[model samples]
Target: MRKMKLPESFLFEAGPRAVLLLHAYTGSANDVRLLGRELQRHNYTVYAPQFRGHASERFEDILDEGSPDKWFADVVEATRFLKEKGYEEIAVMGLSMGGIMATRALEVGDYIGGGSFNSPIHHIGKTRLPETFISLYRSFNKRMGVPDARIQDSIPRIKTKRTQQLEEIAEFSKKVAEDLNQINVPYYIASSGNDELIDPANGQILKEALMPYTEVTYHEFPELTHVITVGPNRESFETTVIAFLNKLNWKEG
Candidate 1:
């Protein structure tokens, strides 16, 4: 199996307290590269795993191999890798879809805290309609024997396979939302008021869901966009994450 020509998984050893950083859907480790470096600078071991089927130069390849289960498995495997490396006190943080997977990771890993940035706990906008249309178009194209590359070039944003993947993810997000109480660990949730992809209200929904079971800190970056981990407000995002980790009060092993 050939891997995408992109940055590999990053690991920086510094302390017993380790932090696992998960990237967003259709995104690779490079998306969280800055945050990983920042965590390492604070003397914490950091590992940012590249999600399966991501980092590919072609979007079609990603759509072909990507799935919600594969994303979840990637996080589980990353946590296990961290534990095997002697990281006892572990924390998880993710951006967007990564945030959804990070929460799921807590169910199977011994994590002290988790952070979510611009993650959607529910679907918004046209939702499945566009995907359905894309699926119909794809079927027609297939019946007509259109070349894959031509089909890809004609409709780059939506594909039947990718639409199905998104639907799977939406279902998973609903499950995570319903089981929010299972997240007993201290969690950090951040959203951008200006985010065009995920509605910022989902942050409040998560905070409300977890209020009865654990500590939840919600922050609204009014000026930022969907990609809060990178771009102009990245410094503030990293600072908030480090502050959250510092306040976790986990004993250094």
Candidate 2:
């Protein structure tokens, strides 16, 4: 539960119709800046805030603090930030961990519409995401010049403890999935047929869960992988997002 002094959040002011982009687990706002810029080019005000413990260099920080409950609180605050800035119409979107947040945001807020990109929404128990995160933690530490030998004990301990937080995320995802029908606004869902961390089949679960009660926009990029907001095929994904936003009945203030 420590703060990182990272000045890496994105706020591109363009129009009154705003967007809140949430980054994936352990990723900074840099993960979504490409898509944010694309949205900005189309005259949307894009705000990509940094999640707690992500901006810091220590992997333990996120392991200890990046629970879904805390992230939901952050997303709520981010939405309020936009409303205070005179933007009444806001759409939320996120990648992976952020996708979960965006879906939950719709349940509680009067959002115009929002969705997720390559989010793991089905069979949370099957994904090797925690292992992926732990691997990423080691890679990041290596990037910071910390060798594996020195951090041997710490990494294992962190891995064991972080599983609890991962469980919290699973619980949150299940709740959001079950509550998808409660949302009155449109929801967008994207999937990668070849995502390394999350199963592509989860897209069907997302579509089926929300389509029965509310409007849902489901799209898939077969050649792409997770975090489409920043890498190859990102532009294509952004176009799909723009089309979704265009169809929304926004009440800009």
Candidate 3:
């Protein structure tokens, strides 16, 4: 079968300093499109890469291929692409699951600083049945070749996969938490106090984890949800990001 074409990623070129924006799990480049545009207006080159299995014809594809490793690969590729283009100073920002990737990128990529929004450093609620069922359903899908199953027929599977993916993400987040001290770059961490998906305490968890090694700026918005980037106070979110970037002092030669 011919692979489905993913949605267009965003790249805006203007200056030697660059910013790589990463979207949430199961989300497309569109999640961070507005932020990318804002950075571009500041004359900062920006790139938002679409993750594998995301933005495809079916959400099932995300279940089959969207692992943390694959998402991190997207981050790695975007950062290297910017470096190859001669951007001497680069920063990475991630939202939700992308936050984990951005945090991990600081350890592997040559970035000056990074930021994360509404990310869970430690997952809440302990449930294993969902992931168990998701594994079974995925196997059933592969055995039956039911890639185009209807919503009613696949809703349980979809929910299971989403839960399972979060479990996987939590595992990775725990690993990142353990090694947070190795990430010696300045970081901006924020979360909503009433985030419906992740516990608001995660923001403090991340901030505290990084405090021993690097500069950490933490913020809490009591009114916003997990998806703060596109919330009612989205302008405020954008302003916060712009301010963080402006403070980097990466002057082009």
The prediction achieving the highest lDDT against the true structure is: 2
Candidate 3 C-alpha lDDT tens digits along 1-253: 3455556898998877799988887567888887888788888889998888877655577779878888888788888888888887899989888888999998767788998998776664433434544554555445445555543477675886677776787788888887787887789987887677667887887787788899887888888877787776778778888888888758669
Error of 1 at 220 (Å): 0.9
lDDT of 1 by residue, 88-202 (tens): 7899989988999998876556799987898887654423334544655565556556687877777865554666777788899888787777777899998888886667787
Candidate 3 global TM-score = 0.84
lDDT of 2 at 132: 83
Q: What lDDT would each prediction earn against the true structure?
A: 0.79, 0.84, 0.78
Tell me how far the alpha carbon of residue 57 in candidate 1 is from the true structure, in angstroms, after superposition: 3.5
**Which 10 successive residues of model 3 have the least lDDT summed?**
124-133
* lDDT of model 3, residue 232: 64
Candidate 2 lDDT by residue in tens digits, 139-244: 7677777766876767768778788887777788889887887788888998987788778888878888888788999998988887777677577788899999
Model 3 lDDT at residue 47: 91
**Colliding pairs, model 2:** none
Which regions of candidate 2 are displaced past 4 Å? 1-7
Model 2 scores worst on lDDT over the 10 consecutive residues at 1-10
User: What is the lDDT ranking, best to worst?
Assistant: 2, 1, 3
RMSD of each: 5.2, 2.6, 5.0
